[model samples]
Target: MLTLYRPGDGPWHRLPAGPKSLVLLVIVLGVSLLPATWWCAAVAVGACVGCYAVRGAGMRDLLRQVVTVRWILLVTLAGQLVFTGPETAVANTARVGAAVVISGLLTLTTPVSELLDVLERAMRPLAWLRIDPQRAALTVAVTLSTLPVLARLEREVREAQRARGGGRSLRLFAIPFLVVALKHADALGDALTARGVR
Candidate 1:
């Protein structure tokens, strides 16, 4: 959500978005390619995890993010554990966790607008193929902006369900959430049109 970006004078904040993104990609790929050994993957994951402390994020903040992605991680762990083994499962899970943490760190340090600018600049050469970098970057920016709105909507829907009591149907929230999301999209589109984004 919007919780990703934290305003501070940290070293990560001082780094350029391009290099940070490149390093993040390399680190994630390198970790993922490492052997599924406890010792090897653990060291890499530990280093990635320690980035939170280096970037001034608190334990509570890190735990909140992990909790948000718990379901996805749980499913991945269960599948790996069943098909492979405990060692592979743990290693794969750690790899995924480290990748997510590193990506989150990038977003936390870089502002969304600046990240979009970096993306646009990187994709400028693709304009020769009729791919508009500005539009592409704007799409990503809008997508990032919607995440926090969706998260807020989810929380509100959950609270409303709890207030009503005696029911546990995902449809109870999904339908309303979809409706609100569509409305948000419509508004966003209208705003973009007004601004002559096209």
Candidate 2:
């Protein structure tokens, strides 16, 4: 699998995973609680960009995060434009983009193992409720790891379609993407099972 963790000696990279995750959660929650306005969205997105700059992330890295969710943003913008107005559409799209960028930054700065460790520690108190902390952490690990893989798969599929002179058809893209994603899921399941994760 492709790792999202970028090695760096930056402050974000040096910070412990627990507090970093808490800050991420707080930012997302705070943004969600804000009114859906252009200023709110702009502030959220601008803050994420500033964080990237502070962490010494290049423009390319920031663009990659935006590119990965371009389709989702387009759809959201279009839908909101139809139901609401252009301002709301822009605000909502920017909010979603900001959230994705923040999450991407977290994954880029923190290793999967560290994130899993934090999750496991946080979940320990729920053991009496029949919650398996290890399993919970595993689920998060799989999710965090799978996002980049899926994003890469999407780009590969899109390139293949372009090579075949195919246009941007969602149905065409979805079919092959889902097929490959399921194959990857199956292989991952087998690997995890072999390691006794199940």
Candidate 3:
């Protein structure tokens, strides 16, 4: 699986995944509710940075994850600016960027197996409703793993287009990317079946 976990001997890595995940959820909820003010944004961003530093992750590692969503952030900022004015847009962007960084920090610190185990355990209560916790956890794991694959595929397609001196064309990229993604999904499904994951 394409997990963001990096092997480290840091305290964050040593922490129990269950509690860590709970804390992550709490932090996300709290942050999401904060007013989109400059100070709130600064605190949110600073907290993420501080957490990374405490966990011994480098700045470049954090930037790598954050940069992936730059285009989305840009578009969001543009729309907010047009609709709500510059101050709100800036605050909103900062709020969003901070959330993304915080999420990335969590994934970077926790291993995929640990995350899945925690998720399955947390969903155990749903068993009373005839819901399969393992299946739900596996689905989430697969979805998380697929994101990096799609991101890498997009980057590869972009690079290939540039190499061929092609103009910016979504049409040229979308079809092949979709085909590759579908094939990847099929292969992933086969692997999961072989492992008796679902």
RMSD of each: 2.3, 2.1, 2.0
Please give each candidate's TM-score.
0.85, 0.91, 0.90
Task: Give the runs in model 3 whose Cα sits over 4 Å from its true position.
Answer: 1-3
Candidate 1 lDDT over residue span 148-194, tens digit each: 57767777777887798826688887787788788888998899999
Q: What residue runs in model 2 are displaced by over 4 Å at the alpha carbon?
A: 1-3
Models sorted by TM-score, best on top? 2, 3, 1
TM-score of 2: 0.91
Cα RMSD of predicted structure 3: 2.0
Best by TM-score: 2
189 Cα displacement, candidate 1 (Å) = 2.2
Q: Choose 2 or 3, whichever is better by TM-score.
A: 2
lDDT of 3 by residue, 1-198 (tens): 222778887877888888877776777666777786778867777766766676557777767776777776798899898999776787788777666667766667888888899889989999999999999987887787677778888888888888988768989888877888888889998999999876
